[model samples]
Target: MADATTIVPLNPDEEKFLRALGTVMALLPRVVDADMLEELPISSTEYTVLVHLSEVPHHQMRMSELANVCGLSLSGMTRVVNRLESQSLVTRQKCPEDGRAWLALLTNPGWKMLEQAWPTNLASVRRHIFSRLEGCDVAAAAEVLQRIAAP
Candidate 1:
């Protein structure tokens, strides 16, 4: 039997794929940040927080839920949301079901900004990711990404 110290190695192609994936992922944030700065007032991370909130039903979600969706910690999300709320982009409402909990609500201004910014955001995404790949390859890439991100 093989010892725990022995492990199978990734083949050359597999290693290359991983290297490319890491590089692309590293650069992806810059792409988003540049585009967001040029087209919107918010940073890419903040835009993503807003985007995640926008996807929820009624354009509202709890702070914990938003943090999870945005891959952020609760405290980090709290800061972002507090900044956003101060900017009039979002509002915090006490959850009726749980007095201690709060829901982040997208304000009318936020909704309007999101609507105006969506097309530019989509364009940047398509330019950086989808446009470079073919149709079938794009679908395969999405599946591969999903598989990689899944637990």
Candidate 2:
């Protein structure tokens, strides 16, 4: 890694772009979280977890896998799972293939919750993002942002 002192400074346009990106990054989550919390019983993070599980084969995933994809620590994920469990939205079960491992399974109610929240989430995205961008603008933004977000 380069030392901070050796790092090159950004040009004015680059600095402005970086600032805009930073602001969006910081605020977008809050906006979505607020929208979800206002209209739904779940937070954005919980919706994210549900979405990932919904995409999986059995609406289930290992706790470690969920934690990784959600960018939460394992213990942090456990707490989130616990909250969902208490709400009857999810269930924790021992992994049949590995007794020591745990899986978070989305319940019927969890799927119902996702179904209920889908329209609000879509509308919020359209309002906050898609409606402001032309088709080509969205395509280009997706390409660049995907590259930046890749692990």
Candidate 3:
């Protein structure tokens, strides 16, 4: 690791921006989690997994792929998938082409759950995020944030 003494502190504008970004990063999840817990049966993480699976061709994806898409560790994804499987929201099956790999497939109930949750999720996003910004603000923020978040 580099020596702490060599590091330069952020300038005031950079500090302000980072603080605001950190606040939003922390608070936005809580806001979304509260809405989800109140209006739906799933948490935000589960919703993310489901949404990604829903976007795929067959409502199914490899466990590792799902983990990557959801930004979860392999073990973390396994735990989440186990919970979802217990709830009958998803099913885990051995991959046909690869005997050692597993696939997570969304169930009918999962689809229904997602459908029911969509309106609540959308409203919460609007209430917490989009409502606070104008169109141009949203576009600019999206561009900037995406750039910052990109690998």
Q: Order the candidates by lDDT, highest first — what do you get?
A: 3, 2, 1
Those runs of model 2 whose alpha carbons end farther than 4 Å from true positions after fitting are 3-6
Number of clashing pairs per prediction, in order: 0, 0, 0
Estimated TM-score for each candidate: 0.87, 0.90, 0.89
In candidate 3, which residue pairs clash? none
Query: For model 3, where is the 10-residue window of minimal lDDT?
Result: 132-141
Tens-place lDDT per residue, model 3, 8-122, is 9999999999999999989998999899999777888898888998999999999999999898899999999998898899999999999999999999999998898888888
Off by over 4 Å in 1: 1-4
Residue 76 CA error for candidate 2 (Å)? Answer: 2.6
Candidate 2 displacement at residue 98 in angstroms: 2.3
TM-score of candidate 2 versus the correct structure, residues matched by position: 0.90
Please report, in order, the local distance difference test score of every candidate based on alpha carbons. Answer: 0.86, 0.91, 0.91
